[model samples]
Target: MDMLPVDRTNAECWQLGTDQITVLTTCAQTSGQIFAVEIRMPPGGGPPVLHRHDPSEVYYVLEGEFTFYVGGEGGVTRHRAGVGDVVPLDGGTPHTVRNESDADAVAFAVHTPGAVMEGFTRAAAVLGAPGARPTMEEVLALADAHGIEMLGPVPAQL
Candidate 1:
């Protein structure tokens, strides 16, 4: 199969939580081999929950500072990453990321054998919209459909 090229101007952008995520490559575009997204986060922006999935994820911090929390059911480890830092999370490793600084942050995230993250991100964008509140049951269902499991809420400091 031939792969087509994609650029920022042609990518699909979504609002997930407080971040603007631009999907660069999707599973469908890569025949299920990989998926990538560029995320722009304002100060204190991040995912609503700490979660885990089957696909391994890598993050390249392009700008600003981000705090990453990674662990399992037992505990978590926190790391503060700045520009040019690369962070990798193994499959099924629970993790969450946030922009704790006063400045905005940009990061490129890639998932190998990209499961259903593309779909999940799209759905989350809609669900996270203003006044579009979804129940916990619905959120859990959505995550489950995408092979993700939410372990806890996002940290207060984030």
Candidate 2:
């Protein structure tokens, strides 16, 4: 069994956005599943592009407000998930979750076995630098390299 101290304060506890940090409690090496804890984000923080996985996922909001966009060719459903709210997502469902509030938002997400959180994290790092945002071509290139499948362009509202 792997044993890691909880007090270890490292940057790994956070990820993506300049103001947000995502602590990973279960990485592929840890729990054999893609699971992580996401910490606060500023209002209108950027959301991930529309993408789908080969496995399912579930998200539980712990604090603040969040909007989950589950979309398809037909339409999109924006779920306003608050504390204690749980959003379960199935494979082949292109979706994204974002913070739409001024306060910090936190959530715990569990992607199924072999999901691409690590790759997502890596790609985010590569495309997450300051100044200009990465182009769609660049984003797809990174996602492709990481085994992620992009469904379409980023949502219009993002």
Compare the candidates by TM-score and give the number of the best one. Answer: 1
lDDT of 2 by residue, 62-82 (tens): 888888888867677677899
Over 37-102, each residue of candidate 1 has an lDDT whose tens digit, in order, gives: 999999999975689989898999999999998885657778999999999999888899889899
User: How many clashing pairs in candidate 1?
Assistant: 0
Task: Give the Å shift of residue 29 in candidate 1.
Answer: 1.5
Off by over 4 Å in 2: 1-8, 26-28, 72-74, 130-133, 153-158
Q: TM-scores across all candidates?
A: 0.88, 0.76
For candidate 2, the TM-score is 0.76
lDDT of each: 0.86, 0.69
- Alpha-carbon RMSD to native, per candidate: 2.5, 3.3
**Residue 5 of model 2, lDDT score:** 53
Pairs that collide in candidate 2 are 14-21, 14-22, 15-22
Evaluate residue 137 in candidate 2 and report its C-alpha lDDT on the 0 to 100 scale. 85
